[model samples]
Target: MRKNGSNGGRAKYQCAKCGYHGYLQPAAPAARYAQVEKLLAERNSQRSIVRATGVSRMTVANLAKKSAISQPTAAAPAAEISPAQALGST
Candidate 1:
């Protein structure tokens, strides 16, 4: 592949043999995201997480929202009543 030109302010490359042209997408920062997730799990505030991890506020919020949606919340236990309580006899 060879550099063709700039596309959308990113370097565009073209296949040397096939004539296919496109911009190479950058890889996701997995390590940074892992750090963000760790800080989030530590109960750090979104702003604090952003400061600590150098990730954007929106990114932190999105990760938090995604994790919340993915994890299942435990159901609250139902209250039990004795026969006397059920009869309102205290």
Candidate 2:
């Protein structure tokens, strides 16, 4: 297919399983996660992340947990892997 010369043209997609169709949305979970990681790496605060990325604070907190960010919690020590264990050795 050729471009329609429109500045805001987006590819339309169809789902065969559900018979769903829609234009592709640019912002996605993985993209948001990557952006969050980048911003977090820069030492940005949660509020800053939420404001800049338009992601909710709860979502940011969830992503932080999923990313295994170091947290000073009582359970944190339980999740640590010894050097030998990390190397898959006994």
Candidate 3:
């Protein structure tokens, strides 16, 4: 049992054990969610995104898939060589 105050007292929660006092604040759901969306847009790696986003990487992947955003594909490498070969024949 403890008294909590804004000044400098412990926040109190009842312990499941033999009756003890504990103090900690749970995270707000919305704040945690916004972090996730931001990270996905940044194209961060899954593990790094999890650390920064405060959400599971799997969630980020799902959002990315659902986002339906298309990225430009790299230029073809083989086509360049073929064009040079075409010019040499003439």
Candidate 4:
């Protein structure tokens, strides 16, 4: 894939407390995006987000994995058939 400007992949960062080395990420190395996505997906209100995540609405909206598909709820099906169909009367 072609990259525009400086994409700058990964970088090494030193842990201040233990002097351990780790890789810093362009998004988030430890899967913070997954959390952001979960929050966004739950349709939680923006004010509630700030109260909980300490991030603004714009940030929450931006960080979400905007392209993922939402699965239909389990208790209800997208399509349903009559009980007679379930029997052998179709």
TM-score of each predicted structure versus truth: 0.54, 0.46, 0.42, 0.37
Question: How many pairs collide in each candidate, listed in order?
Answer: 0, 0, 0, 0
| lDDT values, one for every candidate | 0.89, 0.76, 0.66, 0.58
Give the clashing residue pairs of candidate 1, or none.
none
Per-residue alpha-carbon lDDT of model 2 for 1-90, expressed as tens digits?
Answer: 222233356666666667666665568888988999888878888899999999899998887776665645455446777999999987
Local accuracy of candidate 1 as per-residue lDDT tens digits, 1-90? 999999668999999999999988754689889888888888889999988777899999999999889889999987998999999996
Top candidate on TM-score is 1
Kindly list the per-residue Cα lDDT of model 3 for residues 1-90, writing each as its tens digit. Answer: 334333356466655655665577758867876676677677767688778757777777776676546645677676445766778974
**Backbone-clash count (model 1):** 0
Model 1 regions more than 4 Å off:
1-28, 78-90
Q: Which ranges in model 4 have alpha carbons more than 4 Å from their true place? A: 1-30, 63-84
What's the CA error at residue 7 for candidate 3, in Å? 25
* Comparing 3 and 4 on lDDT, the stronger one: 3
**Which whole-number lDDT from 0 to 100 does residue 84 have in model 1?**
95
Q: Which sections of candidate 2 miss by over 4 Å? A: 1-26, 69-90
